[model samples]
Target: MSIYGYESLTGRTAVVTGAASGMGEATARRLAAHGVRVALLARRAERLDALAGKIAADGGQALAVTADVTDAASVRAAAERVRDAYGPADLVVNSAGVMLPNPVDAGRTDEWARMIDTNLGGALHVIDAFRADLLAAAAEGRPADLVNVSSIGAHVVFPNYAVYGATKAALTQLSASLRTEFGPRGVRVSNVEPGLTDTELGSHIDNAELSQALDGMFQAFGQALTADDIADLIAYTTSRPRHVNLRQLVVLPTVQA
Candidate 1:
């Protein structure tokens, strides 16, 4: 997936949550290459700082803001930091998410709650933190984008991943509603659902049986999508003309039936 002509992304400010690793990290690198000033938001300060340093070394601007998306106060504070450093973010990517697959009968209520907070609640906090900035950018005739990273689980029924899927489904719906409300105002809202991808996401599953099954499935498929693949899609979505909005994209590997 080679994309060209990202002239509009240059000199824009972008806030990317969960920027420490996986899809968020890949997206940050890809956007920085396109000349976007990126703010790296995540709980791991060390990792964020390292990534920021790498971006800086590559002649790109980046700010490492230690933040936990599940905490509204943390997200708010992070937003303020980004504003101070790079001004209002014209692009916001809600990519911080956790997938903990647990069976309903397993009584893993704690895992269920964690997934809800990080996957669903986290996106809300980010949107709330940067809502004004996105609107203001759009009002200024600048391109503003709100990209939410959902999942294929939102549409497919995965046995032990019910709670995780529910949260993603909710996020997908939320993105659609936001598009309706913000589209007229000029902010493009996109919901990106990715199929089987090789990332640390699967490591969060505590269910031993489920974990082995997923590992075997991925091994069989051989070349699952990479984090960079999703990043390319995001870069493409956000770089289109302001009048064009790729509202929903479901990216999947050919091997995944």
Candidate 2:
């Protein structure tokens, strides 16, 4: 098939967690433009609603679902809602995550737990909630895709990012294993690892020193990859032919080592 043919995603339904902002929002918009029905799942109802409105205005179908990925019940409920509204999702994007930066000795146990809950545990919940549906779609000879958003920290560590990196590393491995196990069943899983993107993800860091350091790093790395960059990669992956599974994609600015 021609490369251009892979850009069209019409008649497909996608559920994007963290669809309220940043990469999640961008992915929703991109997929919607290609004629995909999108279910926007996020904790921020207002943001999701606004995004859904925008997508609708652009002549796309979208559903705004208020959900907290860290909560298993909420994730399952969101999946049910999506299935009810749009049938089985052809694509599932696990983009909900949290990042908290601090030294291990900072006594910030709460922040660490929050990061772990949202990043690793939350992704697991979303994947598990929708696994059956995805596999079912695959069984029917349809293309089913699962995209997990990881981070550069998953491959490389940085100061004050121990917990966050650990969570991402876990997510990376989870995606890899899921891909291997499900590939034979006609389900394709991919990991999108982004580096130093401009997003509100860093705002969760309560430590002043760590926050300042991270901000400085971003400033130095100027021209960091935008959410759109990662979103574009996701669109490309999901739009490919049923037999084509782009397993792993790592995106970063040219300046980023």
Candidate 3:
């Protein structure tokens, strides 16, 4: 059980949601480097195809499936495509999310719904759609892994992030409960929480005041964590032995309190 043993994911198949950009892109790239056959799922077909091409160019097996996580049928179809092309998936990563900054009193119901639907509901769709395959893979003696990407907001309370935080918190709990239920069945589940990473999460914030506050917070931290930092953690966790589960890991910049 060397620390680096999981680094070689040769012959394994992985399904990665939100594989178009940011942490998802980095994670997919890293997994492919380790010889994992990766299925890229995202709303952007062009981006997914481009990424798949790059991975293939690097001598890795890759598939690009365009699907919206918010739609259960779409997710199921994507999972089926992956199974048809690469057998059962040995790994699944749910990273699709949305963040819109607004106060609870502002009556921004649409934003709230979008956040919940994409972040929490989307994760549910992916897990439920793929749970059967994951279980079957484990039954065959090849342990499966699931990594759900959460956020620091999942733990801490922050203004204008009520809906976003709630969604992430729910995802965290879901991952924990899933881990308990599946661990005995030879499936490893983990939640990776990242703090203040430089991504497009803040772009949805249209409120000037809220945007300023968030920018100030990031600046106060001096440097925000990079997407690659989170990707590295996910890669390490997924590479572990069948009996070893990393559970929950929270990563933040040193300057972030």
Best by TM-score: 1
In candidate 3, stretches whose alpha carbon ends up further than 4 angstroms from where it belongs are none
> Against the unseen true structure, what C-alpha lDDT does each candidate score?
0.94, 0.90, 0.90
TM-score of every model versus the real structure: 0.98, 0.97, 0.96
Candidate closer to the true structure by lDDT (higher is better), 2 or 3: 2
In the predicted model 3, the residue pairs found to clash are 6-239
Candidate 2's residue-wise lDDT over 153-255, tens digit each?
A: 9989898789989999999999999987999999999998999899888887777888898899888987888899888899888888888899988888999
lDDT of 2: 0.90
Residue 70 accuracy (lDDT) in model 1: 94
Model 2 off-target regions past 4 Å? none
**TM-score of candidate 1 to 2 decimals:** 0.98
- Please give the lDDT score for candidate 1: 0.94
RMSD of 3: 1.3
Clashing pairs in 2: none
What is candidate 3's CA lDDT for residue 68?
98
Provide the lowest-lDDT 10-residue window in model 3: 1-10
Query: Which ten contiguous residues of candidate 1 have the minimum total lDDT?
Result: 1-10
Better of 1 and 3 by TM-score: 1
Q: What lDDT tens digits, residue by residue, belong to model 1 across residues 19-91?
A: 9999999999999999999999999999999999999999999999999999999999999999999899999
Clashes of each: 0, 0, 1
